[model samples]
Target chain A: MTSSTERSERAGAPAFALPFRVGRALAFHELRERTRDRWVIVISALFALLASAVGLYGRSAEGNAAAITGPSLVTLASLFVPLVALALGYDAIVGERERNTLGLLLSMPVGRTEVIVGKFVGRALALCLAVGLGLGAAMLAAAPGEARTLAALLGPTMALGLAFVSVGLLVSTLVSRQSTAASVVVAIWFLFVFFYDLGLLAILVATEGAIGDELVSSLVVGNPTGLYRVSLLASLGGENALTDLGLDVSLPSASARGAIWCAWIFGPLALSAAALSRRALR
Target chain B: MQRLTLEDVAVRFGRIEALRGTSLELRAGEVFLLAGPNGAGKSTLIRVLLGLVAPTRGTLRVDGAPVRADRAFRARLGYLPESVAFSESSTGREVVSFFAAARGAPKKRIDEVLERVGLADARSRLVRGYSRGMRQRLGLAVALVAPCELLVLDEPTGGLDQDALTLLWSVLDEHRAAGCVVLLASHEIALLESRVDRLGLLARGQLVALGDPTSLRERAALPVRVKVAPRADADRDALVQALERVGTIAPVRGARALELDVQPSRLLELLDLDAAHRACIADLQIVPPPFDEVYRRLLSEAA
Candidate 1:
């Protein structure tokens, strides 16, 4: 459709649309392919089951239907979302480069930023579908009342997935091999989810809880996982999930948590896009 | 005017020069064959043309404008990398469709290209199950998803069978007929002979020769080899003496025959030499120097 008029119209179109089209198309295709993958299938099923189990527990419990004890589903999400996100995105760029397909892609009209953006969108969408449906099923089983009760933790949990996908994208661009990228993502996931919080706890106790609420909130916001835990604990205003569990940790304001989540999602993604465009791309 | 021009392009990887002062121009309706041994910067050249690798020095222009700053200029180019590997989960149709979408091409173009590449039958099959040749053809389909002003194929025929090879040639023929410039880099000499409009012999990242096949042969100035066997080993000296009347004759160390370097101009005269020279009294082999020989000699000389 490179007719004289069509070409002129395309020229007149917003210059920004070109990169968006490339990224969107890539994301669409990535999503289509990932949806068919057995790994995605397994993970999605597991998430649905876990979310449904949480919802069912909440429904059967004495807590009001909206959620039970500060959306315990956040804990499950902390475990599964990153795992799924890592699987979807850890190899997005470097994998293509390693396989020699990245050259073929760059040879097209698409730019490097577009490719990275496309990959991020693809992985994010795939992750969203899995975690959203699973968690929705959980809430449905729990019949979580108004959807408002789960809002704080749900956003942060999904943001955590996006953050890890961004992290995975960054890893994909920086590393040269798929296996290496995958390992780095796994190691980072372990640190963020399992180890980082444990170390945070040990420090808090060793220092005799001398850390102020602001310091504790700052430290928690530093890690998306810890941010997710606080969002859930804070959202349970009545249940006092944190105090009941002896956590007694201070949580950041909504605006601050929102900033942290946005940073988690967008920061690594921006870096990934920049690094890929700068890559030598042999 | 040249459809594409690379002026004094030098690509340095760290301290190593992958492409050194390689300046060349290509025109529409020309099939440019880039023949060099492995690591002679053939792939690097194609990568630069595709704008995949930024040249460390000099400039590359397409249609009279520097394309490095205008990444969008690459829309008019199609490139098939040496080895194409896609996500294993994607079917051939999905792979081609993704490329087609990326190129902003029509959905129908995917089927057309796949059918043209003989991959239509396998389009529904996952690429993980594809053989090396099938994957290459899939790559070709991706490159052909849209019309291109310039087509750059790196080692296009490495894993292709005879049928695929024929298809590739025919496709190149069509592209040339449509006045598309095609840059083909391959070690395979078979695609170099008559199909190539211009053969570029690259060695050590420099373009040593850039001309038609016939002109390159003429430039090489290689002599035609005439191997002769005397009726008996004792008759070889007599045959050598007579053959020297036409051109240089050297003894084959292990054979009863001697190898004579026949000048192209003196070939007819040598044929007219007395049958009694007895050098060909048993068997004869007239070896005309072709492109491969010229290619080998150029690379060795560069080394």
Candidate 2:
């Protein structure tokens, strides 16, 4: 008689195909859960309100909404997108663990890497939809002719969201408590969006020009939020936005910035997967 | 899937040894019940078997081939945790569908499992509205969404009411009839004793005893209670004198019946006495030791 193992093996899907299949299922479930929770609608409405406010402010200040709203929204998104991404992702894994669902999820015929990937993808998609719907509607109504710039702005904003979501997932994986993960992600947001540039400025001022342009440029690129701002400014036909306004800096090429954003997106996610695979699910 | 063995499996959490040199072989078509007190490593053993916890020293083999709990390997196993939790936002149907998809079960199986677990009427209701018993049934639906070679449940009947428990037993029977290996850890020994094909008692991170109920009772060697109802005109003094020679007669239930504790080995002697005094004995009932008592005795001995 054929062993039960052999029979199951025969009935099972090919091993290579299982990961993506499982990941897709998890991703879909996660998306459905978030959508049902009204997370997408709430965040989307928040984004729309903020983007519209920025448009009105730009129109009143610059007298040319189309020219000003695109770049203004880019700057606005640099701060808001990461915050939104962090809020959405800080509890992705840790919350599941706290609620006693992570073990059940891992108990399925799915790999840890697949679980992390699925969660990231699902949350990233939700962020994308929120940002797209919220900002897209506002930009179209406020700056009908700046579609190109709006399109350019959306990519980096979503990229920044992905990067921070990856960071949030990494935090979620490394910590056991949701509160700790939340606190850490908040600190990370402060360091990157607020304190990072201040610290950089402190170094530049203290050094009194001792920090060269290359070092300053590399330092700006080191922070994903800064990289997002610079990339968006450059893509919107303003290469000297960072150098002329902030410091003496030369931005990397668009392709190089794209590659770095990809790194920012995948690097922490890879680490999260590795850490989860080694973790003991009790 | 025919035979899964954990050879000398051991697990330690820092300075605490949760399991030590635990070895077990599970075969198809057998329901093995694991019984123990709190902190007796029952959950730890279950975790070790599910590959959630890596044993500090041991191997898990399926049909004699060493295997990890990879996707393909776990595909043949279904698990119900002690506390079953789901995303409160998802409906019962959606939750079951998700697990079915994860296990590569057909879409049709979602409705089948929901109906099987008696969640068909409330399939569209969100889980946050479910009571503890309903959540348990949903968990069972998730576990039963797909067929497998092994079914592992940990405290599956925690919040189940009578009907849900009936459903659980029927599902277990289906799996057992299908030749699946069912491994469960529960404190409900009395309810599960007669259903289990084999019983393994764990105490202080070790397998203290393993056998069928009859064998375990024999090993425990606890006294069996024999109750005899005598006819109103029968000779109670003679019956008591005859029973006192083989066992200790209890001083209760005056005149209506005679109750005594007799060793299992001396049961035949008591029966012979009953046969000789048939005219005086109206009814004779032999009650072996309760399973929980046997389980407690074994645990104390191991301790």
Question: Could you give candidate 1's per-residue lDDT for residues B84-194 as a string of tens digits?
Answer: 787788999999888777767777888999999999899999899999999999989888887777888888987899999899999899999988899898887655578
Name the best candidate (by lDDT).
2
- The lDDT of each candidate is 0.79, 0.82
lDDT score at residue B144, model 1, on the 0-100 scale: 85
Q: When only chain A is evaluated, what TM-score does every model earn?
A: 0.86, 0.88
- Per-residue lDDT tens digits for candidate 2, residues B173-235, read 887898888999999988898888998998889899999998998888899999989888988
Model 1 / residue A147 / CA error / Å? 7.0
What is residue B28's positional error in candidate 1, in angstroms?
1.1
The superposed Cα distance between candidate 1 and the true structure at residue B33, in angstroms, equals: 1.4
List, residue by residue over A1-282, the lDDT tens digit for candidate 2: 345455445444333444477799888887776555464466667777888887666555654543477767877787778887888788889998888778778877777899999999888888888788767865665645555556667777888999998999999999999999989999999999999999989998899969888998988987999888777666564666555555466788868887888899999999999999888875
